[model samples]
Structures are given as structure tokens and as C-alpha cells.
Target: MNKTISIIGSGFSALSASCYLAKAGHKVSIYEKNDAVGGRARQLIKDGFTFDIGPSWYWMPDVFEKFFNDFGKSTSDYYQLDKLSPAYKIFFSDDVITIGDHMDQICEEFERIEKGSSKPLRAFIARAQEHYDIAINKVVLKPGISPFELVTKETVTRIDRFFKTISTEVRKKFKNPKLISTLEFPVLFLGAKPSQTPSFYSFMNFADFGLGTWHPKGGMYEIIKAMKTLALSLGV
Candidate 1:
């Protein structure tokens, strides 16, 4: 049955929901409190310079590809994406750490910080990759209507991860303060301290070094614009 649906925001998640709902034969309308529809992913322009107000890095390209593929389109149809080499640099008082685009380079960088650290880094990322598979492919797909949605053969085996903190996990393997800080940095994106964030979220590390970072031709706003365009095409 077709029904009129009003969404409260025009963020990426809201816009995505509106598109899916509209495609399912519903009338969807998005309301944005801000002047633009990108929500936190909005752009800021000053003089002749443009800046992405939020979420500058483009990780998990597969997820973005999956979203676009559902609409019979590809990301290239909307914006060009380029992978970043030496993805980013971390600055400390007396030292600097550069995160490379791939695991090999990242491993080498880790070795420079602490001898024999790359071996453990590889093992750590290997576990993170497994978590990535389960979290992204299985856990995220669940409807989240019940806690039982998280109970599965894969999750059952790794129940300890949910109880452990990323800080603990990183500290257990790495002794250098700089190296520990570097490993735990990724989970900060979850808006939680490393000591509070679950070790399971180390999958973020895999998302970083495994998938590599990317950027759109213009800015991160291009993705929002693309999603908005897709939503409108679906009659949202």
C-alpha cells in the first residue's frame, strides 16, 4: 500500500531511508532544519575555498557501492572517487606517524615505531578483518528489533570482544605509547574513549588499513548530493 511519509531530517541515513521507502511505492518527504540537505555531511564555502563540514574520509567503499547498486546505478555515475595514498598523518609533540593506504605500508610504518611490531599489527588486523566480515556482512544486516538479533554462531564465539575495550586490547599487544595511541585512534570516530569502546569495534582498523581511504572529486558532500539526487529520482 502506498502511504505518505514525512522524515524529520535529510541526513545520509534519513535520505537513504526516504529513497528506499519511496522506491517501495510510498510518498516520502524530507524536512531539514538547516538550509541544506546534507545534514552533518554538509559543505562550507568561504571566499573561493570549499570545505566539507563533516566526515571527510571515505572508507568502506563496498558499502557505498552496495547502496548505489540498489538503485541500478554506480558511484561513478554520480561522482569520481580517488583513493588517498599516505591516507593521513598523526602529529605528536616530537614525532609524526603516517598511515599508509594499504596494510603493507601501514605495517612498515608500525615497524619504524617499534621493532617487531608489524608482526603483531598483522595479527591484530587479521582478527579485525574477521570482525569486519561479521559486523558488516552479518550483524549490520539484522533489523535490530531484538537483542537476540546479535546472537549467532559467529558472534557467540567472539563474545569476549564485546566485554573487552579497545584500549585493553591495544595495550595488551603494543608497549609504546605512540603505537598504542595510533592503534586506538580509529575507535575515536565512534565518539567514545578507547577505554570505553568495545574491542569489537577494532573492525574500524580493518576499515582503515584494509579498505583504504578515498575521496570524491569535489568533497564528501558529493556523496550527500548523490544520495539526494537518487532520493529525488525515486520520487522522495
Candidate 2:
């Protein structure tokens, strides 16, 4: 027997749920309060210049790719992704530096900006990659219903990371203020200060420098578009 599923919000998570439920022999319907869907990710078109009005950066391309893959579709089927060469640029009082897409270029930039900094940057990224892999591949699947869901061997071994903040960790690793600030910026996504945000969340740096930043030509809204299309295709 098929069950009827109603998704309350039309945000990314809601749309993704609809697609999954619809594909699982269920009737899925989305109820969005706003006139337009996508919640915060919705676009605003005006004066011949389109505006995303929401998220501009697309982190974790692998996550998006996995979402499409689960639905027997590829992200390329919806929209093309072009990896940004300089992942992003930082403008300071006297100069601007663009973080490059490739690690070599990024390391070179670090070396030029701060002598002997590239080696530590490389080491930091290597450890961050481990955290990234464990968090994404292992921890993300945990159900929030139980605290035990977080009590894995990996989490047990890395328990100390939770107590330390990103700022503390980065400051201990790198001495350059510019580098430390740049590294801290990604943790801002957690809605807390890097000094307050846990070092465990530094996987975001991996998401930044390790995985690299990307844009889906149209806008970040393309992810919502793809999820909506997938839901409809699944007969939601």
C-alpha cells in the first residue's frame, strides 16, 4: 500500500524528502506558504538582471551529485557545474587575494603571502580531509533521535575536537592573520563565531579548499530547481 506524504516547507530539505518519499511507493505533495517555492533559495527576477536572493555559494558538489545519483539522474542532466578557478577572493585594506581552485596554486599563493606557510596549510588540509570524509560519509547518516547515534568509534577517538574551537585550532596551526581569517570565514556558516564554533566543524575548510567551490551556471537556485524537477518526475 502507498502512503500519502505531505511536506510542509518547499525548501531544499522538503523537496528532497518529497522526491525520496514519492519514489518509495508513496504519494507526495508539497505545501509551501509562499507564492513561490524554494523558500530562502528562491530567485527574484527584475529589471533584466536576475537575482538569487539567497545562497550564492554551492559547497559540497559531491553531496549534490549524490542527491541526483540516488534519483537515477546526474546533476549534468539538470544543469552544468563549472568549478570556480579562484574559489573565492578576499579583499583587504591594501590588497586582494584570490584562493585558487587547484591545491598547487593555492599552496603557491600561501607561500608567496607568508613564508613557509604552504607546508602547514598542506598538513592542515590533509587532517581536514579526514574529518570531511568521516563527517560526510559516516556521521551525516546518523538519526538525530538518539544520542547514541553520535557514539561511533570515529567520534569517540575525535572527542577532543568537539571541545576545541576552529579559531583555536587554526591559530595554533597557522600564524598569518589573513590565512586564519580566511579559514575562519567558512565556519561562519554555523551561525556562530569561529572562536565559538567547534573544531569538528573545520571540515568546512575541506569543503572549501579540499573539495573546491563551484557554481551551477544559473545560480545556487538551480539545486532547488533540480530537486523540484526530481520530485515531479517521481510523481510527487
Candidate 3:
């Protein structure tokens, strides 16, 4: 059934929601406070260089693929992704570590730095993947209307795993301060200190060091262009 839906923002979330809603036969219109769309994903042009002011990193390819797959398309149809080599550079005090392109190489590097640490790193990654799986599949996808919305028995059991601070959990696993700091740096990108962000966010490290980073061929702004085309194709 086609229903009228009014989305109040022009951010990626709003644009993505509009695309899927429109694809599902909803009459969708997006109202934005800003003159241009893309909200935080807004584009900035300077000195012949363009930048996506926010979310420049395309971290979770699988999530994007699943969203595109929902509309009977793959991400490749909209944009090509080139995996970043060395993934990203990490700075720790006076030391620099460039995380490599492959998971086995990353693990080898981790083990080389801190002996007997690879197993814990693997375990941490496994738990982080579990958190990501649960978050996208069961929690984040839902509109949390209340605390009760997340209080099922399964969620109750799993809640403790996410309750600890990422810093605390990472410290509990890795004894090397530099390695711990390198792993925790990305947590700051979540808009919170590691001590405040939930441990589930370690999945970022899973996506970062494990899954690797990617960029659209043209530029990050290309994502906005692709999304605009997608929204227009869905009849706005």
C-alpha cells in the first residue's frame, strides 16, 4: 500500500529511509532546514578540491550492500569501491603503526608486537562481530520507542556485553599500552571518549582492521551524487 511519508531531514539516514520508503511505494517528501540536501554528509568545495564534510569513510560495506540489495541493486551498480591499502595509519605517542590490508596480516602484526596477544585479539574481534550482527539485524534497525523496546530476554542477556566501556574492555584484553591506544583511537570518532562509548563499538575495529577501508572512485561526494540519483530514480 502506498502511504504518504514526510521525512524531516536530508542526512544519509533520512535520504536512505526516503529511498527505501519510496521503493516500497510510499509517497515520500523530505523537508530540510538547510537549503541543500545531504545534511551532515554535505559537500564542501575549495581550491578545486571537494570534501564530504562528514562520514568520509565507507567502513561497513556489508551494511551498504544489504541496503542496496533491498532495492534489487548492489553497491557496485551505484559506485565502485577500492579497498584502502595499509587500511589507515595509527599514531601512538612517538610510534606509528600502519594497519595492513588483510586480516591475517593485521593479526600477525598484533601478535608480533605483543606476544600471546593474538588469541585475545581474535576473541575480541569475534565478540565485536557478534555485536555488529545483533545491532544491525535486531537493534539498530528498529525504532527504539522506549527502554522496554530493548528489554527482551535475549537482549537482557546480551546487554552486559555492551555495558562496559570500550577502554575498560580493551585494557582488559591487551597489555601493551600502544596497541590498546591504537585500537581505541577510532572509538573517539564515534563522538564520545572510549570510556563513554559502549564496548560494542569495538566492532569498528573489527570493520577497520578486519574488513578494511574503502573509497568511492571519484570522491566521497560521489556518494551524495549516487544517493541523489537513487532518490530521484525512486520518484524523489
Candidate 4:
């Protein structure tokens, strides 16, 4: 039996949900409080220049690719993605450091700052990559409505990581404060300090230097545009 579904916002999450629900034979209607469809990703035009109100960083490009692929569409079909080299810059009170998009150059940067640290950094990222695979391929796909949703065998074995902090994990691998800060920056994307976020979430580091940063040809709004387009095409 088909049921009517009302989603309160038309952001990415809401739009994505509406697509799935509408496709599943539900009558889905998205209600947006704002004039625009995209909540935070909405673009503002001033003085003939475009500016995005929030979220410019495209940290996990693969996640976006996977989302579009699930809808029988590719990210390329909507907007072009450009990978940023020297992905980002961090400014300290004393100096500034550039983070390269690729692992090789990023590891080289680590070697330059703290000699012999690159090898351990590689090992650190390897563990982070493993965590990334587990979290992205398994954990994220599960609905969060039930505790049983997270009680899978893989998460059970990796349970120890949830008790540790990203700060602890980074400090265990690198003695240099700079190196530690660089590793911890990705954790901040969760809006939590390193000491507050779980070590298992260090997969963010892989999402950073490993997967690299990216941007659509136009701006972050392009992704919202694509998602909204997909939802509309699905008869949501």
C-alpha cells in the first residue's frame, strides 16, 4: 500500500529521502520553509557575483559519486568536479602549512616538518583507510532507528575504537604538535574537537589527504541543484 510522506525541509537529506520514498510508491511532498530548495547550500547573488552561504568544501567526493550512482545517474551527468591540489591551507600562530591533495606529496610534507614521521603517517592513514571502508561501506548505509542496526559483526570487533578519541590516536602516532593538528583537522568537520570525537571516525583523515578535496565547476550549490533535480525527476 502507498502512503503519503511529508518531509519538512528540502535539503540534501530531505531531498534524498523523498527520492527513495517516492520511488518506493509513496506520495512524498517536501515542505521547505525557505524560498529556495537548498537549505544551507543556497547561493546568494550580490554585485553580480555568486557566493554560497555555507559548506564549500567537498571532502568526500566518492560519497557524492555513490549517491548519484544509486539513482542511475552519475555526478558527471549533472556537474563537473575539479579536484583541488594542495587541497587546503592551515594557519598557525607562527606559520602556515599547505596540505596536498595526494598522499605522496602530503607524506613528503610530513617528512619535511618532522623527520622520519612520514612512515608512521603512512601507517596511520592505512588504519584510517580501513576504518573508512568499514564505516562508509557498512555503517553509513544502515538506518539509525534501531540499536540493532549498528550491532553488526564488523562493528562489534571494532568496538574498541569508539572508546578512544581521535586526539589519542593522533598523539600515539605523531609527537609533533603540528603533525597532530593536521591529522585532527579532519575530525573537526564533525563540529567536535579531536578529544571529543571517536578514534574510529579517523576515517576522516583518509577522506582528507587520501580521497582529496574537490569542487563542482560552478560551486557547492551545483550539488544541491543536481540532487533537487534528481528528486523532481523521481516524481517527488
Better of 3 and 4 by TM-score: 4
lDDT of 1 by residue, 73-157 (tens): 9999999999999899999999999999888899898899899999999999999999999998888877789999889999999
- Candidate with top lDDT is 1
lDDT tens per residue, model 4, 1-236: 99999999877899889988988989989999988888877889889999988788898888888888888899999999999988998898987778897888898888888999999989888989999999888888888788788777888899998999999988988998988889988887788899989899989989997899998999999989998899889888
Which of the two, 2 or 3, has more TM-score? 2
lDDT of 1: 0.92
How do all models score by TM-score?
0.96, 0.96, 0.88, 0.96
Name the candidate, 1 or 3, with the larger TM-score value: 1
Cα TM-score of candidate 1: 0.96
The clash count of every prediction, one per candidate, is 0, 0, 0, 0
What digit string (tens of lDDT, one per residue) describes model 3 on residues 1-236? 68999999888888898998998899999999976788888888789987778787888888888877887878888888999888887776677777889867778888878998879988888888877776667776677787676665656787776678899998999999878887787776678799888887777777777678899897676676677778888987
Of candidate 3, the 10-residue stretch with the lowest lDDT total is: 147-156
Give candidate 3 regions above 4 Å deviation: 1-3, 32-36
Residue 175 deviation, candidate 4, in Å?
A: 1.6
RMSD values for the candidates in order, in angstroms, are 1.1, 1.3, 2.3, 1.2
Question: Considering only N, C-alpha and C atoms within 3 Å, which residue pairs clash in candidate 2?
Answer: none
lDDT to native, each model: 0.92, 0.88, 0.81, 0.88
- What order do you get sorting by lDDT, best first? 1, 4, 2, 3
